[model samples]
Target: MGKVYIVGAGPGDPDLITVKGLKCIEKADVILYDRLVNKELLSYAKSEADLIYCGKLPNYHTMKQETINTFLIKYAKKGKVVTRLKGGDPFVFGRGGEEAEALAKQSIPFEIIPGISAGIAAPAYAGIPVTHRDASASFAIVTGHRKEDAEEEVKWENLAKGVDTLAVYMGVSNLPYICEQLIKYGKEKSTPAAIIERGTTSMQRTVTGTLGTIVEVAKKEQIQNPSMIVIGEVVRFREKIHWFEKQAENAYPVSGVL
Candidate 1:
């Protein structure tokens, strides 16, 4: 029986894919990719490989998780080298663990290849370090989205008052709620925060403001998902660095803090 490979395709930049992850794409007989994965990477696949789209948007799924698992099992059982390519590290909110568990239960041989998660890469490309020697020494990655009306399990108190920096994923839709929680739970309303939209790509856009004003800034900027929210003093560094935006300016020439 052929084995299954669950691989990370990195954030958005096609070049950021790890060597091993790229190899999986090249050798796979069937590739199931997510919405956020860079389409450019598909060029590396073998001539006859079958590419499947399994992308999901907020509250909408093109392919159900169970269907994906069934495909992995069915293809592997047929002796096909199957690759499940997801955006970002498969284990880091990419549902890699669930897929792995399904494979394990079926006794299917599989390998997991990790990729660069946007939590760090997004901020880096935006010139904001998640952790700095003086401004920040501790960092936390938290999910910005949750089931509708779901109980809030995230420790906002600790995250607000304890963590030195926070890299929030998929939190743009709930920006107001996130800001209010942090401030209500002990974070300073004046704390600096920034959003890096479509980060690590030529289309990257960044907006910076205090916790109290970021919601308005995001609204005005029309920043959308596939974005990262970086909070803490580390965000202050963007004014000094922000090299990617500068590079983008040379190529795309955007206006005003994007």
Candidate 2:
């Protein structure tokens, strides 16, 4: 049986892909890629490599998770080197763990390749460090999307009181709810916050405000998903060191602070 490599394609910028991840793409016989993956990486694949699209939108799935698992097994059973390329780290909200479990159940040979997640990368590119010596000492990566049927709610209380920095993913749509939870759980309403949209790419945009004002700022900017919501004092650094946006020729104009 051939081996399977679950690879992270990084956050948008093709150059950010790891050397090992690039090698897997270069040698794979079959590649299943997600929507958020930069298409430019596909150029590294062998000419005969089979490419399949498995991108999913919010509330819409182009390819079901079960179907993806089936394809991985099918390709590996055929003795073809299979590469599953996903955006960011496969384990971070990428549903890569579920895929790994499926492979494990079947005793399929597989390897996990971690990639740079947007949570950290986005904030950094925006010149907002998730953790800093003076501004922050604790950090947390959270999902903005929560299932209504989830057995337990996210521990917003701890996050508000314990964490110094929060990098929230897939949260543009639920911005108001997130802000409400944080404030309701002891977080200061004036806590600094910022949204880095389409971070790390040429099209990145950044907007900043307090927890109580960011919702309106985001709405005014028409920020969309694939954004990182950063909450902490570190966000104040963006004005001084936001180097990427200054260098990005195509970056969107910065929105005014509230």
User: Which candidate leads in TM-score?
Assistant: 1
Task: List lDDT for all candidates, in order.
Answer: 0.93, 0.91
Location of the lowest summed lDDT over 10 successive residues in candidate 1: 146-155
Model 2: how far residue 245 lies from native, Å? 0.5
Candidate 2 pairs with clashing backbones? none
lDDT of 2: 0.91
Off by over 4 Å in 1: 147-154, 252-258
- Candidate 2 lDDT tens digits, 57-133: 98799999999999999899889999999999999999999999988888889999999999888888999988889
Structural similarity to truth (TM-score) of each candidate: 0.95, 0.94
Give me the displacement of residue 209 in model 1, in angstroms: 0.4
Measured by TM-score, how close is model 1 to the native structure?
0.95
Q: Which runs in model 2 stand beyond 4 Å of their true positions? A: 149-154, 249-258
Per-residue C-alpha lDDT of model 1 across residues 23-100, encoded as one tens digit per residue: 999999999999999999999999999999999997799999999999999999999999999999999999999999
Q: For residue 80, what is the lDDT in candidate 2?
A: 91
